[model samples]
Every structure is written in structure tokens, then in C-alpha cells.
Target: MRPTVHDIAAAAGVSLATVDRVLNQRPGVRRITREKVETAIREIGYVRDVAAANLAKGRTYPLVFILPASDNSFMHGLHAEIREAMIRSPSERTSIRTVEVAAFDPAALVTALEKLADERPAGIALVATDAPEVVAAVDRLVADGIPVVTLVSDLTGSRRHHYAGVDNIAAGRTAARLLGRFLGDAKGEVAVLAGSMLVRDHRERLEGFAALMAQEFPKLSILPVLEGRDDPELAHMLVADVLSKHERVIGVYSLGAGNRGLVRALKARASSRPLTVVAHELTVHTRAALIDGTIDAILNQNAGHEVRSAIRVLKAKADGLAVIDAQERIRLDIFLKDNLP
Candidate 1:
């Protein structure tokens, strides 16, 4: 196989971004670093022909990011990362526009997707809501020759060009293992909190978590999943009610945002024994919960990395270039109190 930019970066002992800057002849690289990249390119026999590639795709791309309009900390962080990407857009020769719709509202998401389809942006990166209408809209975009990538959450049966997120099933199984081990021989019940079942990621997570729990930890009972819609107040109320109703509940696997509410409910509960909580995403609330012994483990997908990966994938698809799958894969991060960053 021909050496790609990744090979050049590895050979030069530099970052992928730096390699891009050097290859694109963008500013801000030190003379030594530029020389090292060039030397690596020559040694690896990596023929970039960036001028030809640029000439092939002469138009600047206008990409759109459709994120959920939620007050959740994770959503805020995702938006912050997208803003950072916007800041770096000039160097990438792309302009970004962001649209926000209500979280867990499938109709709203479908409407937003339809609106973007009419505009026909070069590429679209979306945090998808699993709905038939949304999927149809994605099909329309794909048919129109527009690159569509799902960010964070995925939509099945859609012609999306790529999914720039973690393997959520693995994430769920990992969460279940952490919670099960944390519980040890103790047997009770595990309550699950999710954002919405409409999202493929959340559904896949619950499936993996339940399957593992049934397979490995047979003694532990899993309660029906409660949807919090990624809302803190709703999550707090649902969690509080579940805790109140089930005295034997010993663990919680939160597969979505609304951790602020989960933490609040746990704190307000009048129980002598604490529940083993394994939750998704590392946010301010989840981190504090982990530190204070309210949450056991945090399964995290780095928002910045996901956003950056989506942008990279979309740009590559827009330019009719192949993306390095290994380089674009987003990692699932597991954080404990000791390993918090």
C-alpha cells in the first residue's frame, strides 16, 4: 500500500496535524519540523501531489454540524469542541455552520435534516436521532451526492458516509463489567438510565449491558431502563423515584448524559450504602461524582476528538479522498478517580 499522511507523521515523529500543515504548506511549522516531514516523505516515498488534489476539488466546502440543543454538560463540551474546530477551519479550507434541535425530539431532528437537505451543503456532520424520517432525509442527502457523517450517535440503515464515535456496544459491556466487578459477591439490582431508546448508541449500550449482566452476573437483576431525555431535572426525578421504589438497588449504569441529575439524586437519597455507578461521558458532574465516591467508573468518548474526526472524515469525503480508518477511529476512554484528567 502507498504510504499515506499517517505513515509520514509516524516516520517524522510528528502529529498528524503538523504533517497536514507541512503538506498543505500552511503556516506555523518550525523549519526543523518541516525539514523532518519532508525528509520522511522522501524516505517513505509518499507521493502527496496536494496541488493536483486541490485542483481536482477547487471549491471550498461549507460543512454543517447538527448537534442537539441540550443543557447537558457533555453537549456543552461537544459544542465547545465544534467551536474549536470552527476556529481551525480556515487552515482546513472549510467553513462550518452549526444547527441545534431539541434533544430526544425525533421530529425536530427530522425537520432539521430536511432543511439542510434543501440547502445542500458540501458535507454534514450530525448527532443523529434514530428515526425513519431522519434516515430518509440522510438517504436523500446521500443520493444528492452530499457526504453525511453521524457524530457521537449513529443512525442505522442510513447511507451516512461515516460514524465518528466509539463502539457503543463495547462501551456498554465495559460499563457492565466495571459495575459487576465493583459489586463483587453482593447481589441486588442494577438500575439503568438512558437518554433515549431512539438513539442507536443508547439502545446498543443497553443491549450490551443487559446481555453481559445476564451472561456473567446472573444474580444481579436489571431494572427497566428509564429515559431521562438527557435532562438533568428529569433524570434526577426518575433516578430518585427508582431508588425510592427499589431498596435492593445496588448499582446504576447511566448510558447517557443527565449525569448531573443522577449525581444529584444519589446525593439526595437517604441511604447508608452507596450504589456502584458506572456512567458514560466524563463531564464536570461525573468527574466530581467519581471523585466523591458517588460514581464508580466513567466511560468517556472524547468530544474534541470525535468532532475533529468528523471534520476530517467529512473533508476527505468531500474531496473524494480516502480516510485512514485507523487514524479516524475514536477511542473509548475509561476513567476512574485516580486516572481523571
Candidate 2:
């Protein structure tokens, strides 16, 4: 049989009450008695299950998820995952709260972090707006001994404990390769559309895409990136205008959200120019677009998996425990028209 507190008392020549006092570090137990119980536990290889102990003691970690108040499909999906985690929070011993700030506003994000620091929750996770002030705020929280994790978009050069997102640079390079190979030497100007350059993921994706395109596909020229602010209307306006003017633009790459606008613009293009389009995130619109042969390929990351990872890492950090790196690594997913999931 597995050794229990009774075994420790029997081996240490102590009463059951004395064993409990020693194991729980109660004040009544003497140092010598504690040492004897400890020795007995070591000899018997007693292992305490932390989850069960926390449950028995009614210990809960209060966690906060700071998100952007955007109308993006991916953000909605992320919110859904957090809600799912909250549903399981009773059994998981977690109390989760969500805070939304204006998207792409660094000052708002810093203000939120400072307020959260004052509240002093056990852990905080955010969709970081990559900026100097935001990094400073994150570092301040870390210095205050708070476990901070960056979710989705990350803050560059921040002291955040973990990032629960995919390798955006690799995702971007992959998008470039897919678009380039799809074009197959029929090179022309490739127009780029983006939500914003304020987030690390979008910037990293653009960096990778441009670098690989310049190094390998020199024949295909890249146009200036159109900032759509991830708004469907804005994206549609920009893409539709670009399509009307640039007759030679044969390929398009959307490295951020606002794909709904992109799809609408592509469908409404005045010219029947064949454009090989590549985008990110697997959503209802993106799925339909891919199936209908509008977007050539999509690179995606599981938002639900990222949210779960952030919570796991946060709990581990709060308890001063090490997390398995393999379990925490967020992987990239590639999808094509032939394979949609």
C-alpha cells in the first residue's frame, strides 16, 4: 500500500496528531519531532499531490486576462476559450477575470497593467501592444513579483514570464513561401494588407515575409503595406482601391486580422486579375474564403490552446514550479483549400 500519514507516525514513533502537526508545520510540533517525521516520510517515499491538497484546502489562484476590445474574429475566439476555462475553474481551483482595453493603444494598456498591479492578482495575461511604455509597465509588474504572461500579440523586450502564441516570424515566412510557390514565377507587384504595426506578431510576420521574398523571389515586387486597422470597412476600401490602380498586382498577403474586409474586396475586384492571396487565422470567413478558392492558404494558431497554456503557466509561476516546455509550446497550423479544419 502507498505510504500515508499513518505510516509516518508508525515509523517515527509518534501519535497521529503529532504526525499531522509535523506534516502541516503546525506550531505545536517541536523541531526534533518535525525532523523525525520528515525522516520517516523520506524513507517511505511519501509524495503529496498538490492538486488534491489545494482542493482540500480550498486554495484558489485569482488570474486576470487583459484583452483588446476589438471586433476581430480571433479575439472573439480567444474570449470563448477563456470562458471555457472559467467554466472549469471550479475544479481547476482558479478564479479568472477578464479586462479589456482599447486595441493598439499603448497608454491604455499601461494604465490597465498599473491598475492590475495595484489590485495584485495572483497572475496577469494580456494581448500586449508592443511599445516601450507597455514593456516598462510589464517589467514593473514582474519586479513587483507578479507573474505576467503575454497572450496572442507579445510585448517586445518585456520581462513577461511567458508568451502563449505561435512563432509569428516562422508563420510569416511560411506564408511567403506558400504565396510565392503558388504564383510559380508569374511575378508582379504583391500588395500587402495589415491590421496594425503596433503588435509584435504582425511586425514579425511582415519581417519574415519580406526577408524571404527579397532573398528568394526577387522577381515579385512588394508594394507598401496598407494599414487597415483590422476594420472590415477600412480593409475593403484599401484593398479595393489597390486592386483598381495596380493592374500588375498578381498576389496579396494579409499578415493580420481584418480578413473579412479583404475577402469582400477580393470578391468585388473590378478587374478579373488572378491574385494568389495568403492570410492568417482560421475563422468562419477565412474558412469559407479558402473553400471558395479566394485565399490560397492560411496559417493559424489555436487560440483555445494558447489561452489554456497561459493559465497553466500562470498557475505554475504562482506556485514557483517549473512548467514542461513541450507542453507550453504553441504550434503553428497551415491550412489549404484542400484541407480545411
Per-candidate total of colliding backbone pairs? 0, 0
* TM-score to native of every candidate shown: 0.84, 0.90
- lDDT per residue as tens, model 2, 1-341: 78888888899999999987776678998888889999999999987655566667888999999999988788888999999999999988899999999988999999999999999999999998899999999999999999999998877688999999999989889988998899888869999999899988989999999999998899999999998888889999999999999999999999988999999999887248678999999999999999988888999999999999999999888877788999999999999988775
Q: How accurate locally, in lDDT, is each candidate?
A: 0.90, 0.90
Name the lDDT of candidate 2: 0.90
Q: Mind giving the per-residue lDDT tens digits that candidate 1 earns over 21-119?
A: 998789999999999999999999998765356755565779999999998999999989988988887777778989999887889988888888788
Kindly report which residue stretches of model 1 are placed more than 4 angstroms away from their true locations once superposed.
1-52, 55-59
| Pairs that clash in candidate 1 | none
Q: What is the lDDT of residue 209 in candidate 1?
A: 94
Residue 12 accuracy (lDDT) in model 1: 94
Please give the RMSD to the true structure for each candidate, in Å: 9.7, 2.4
The TM-score of candidate 2 is 0.90
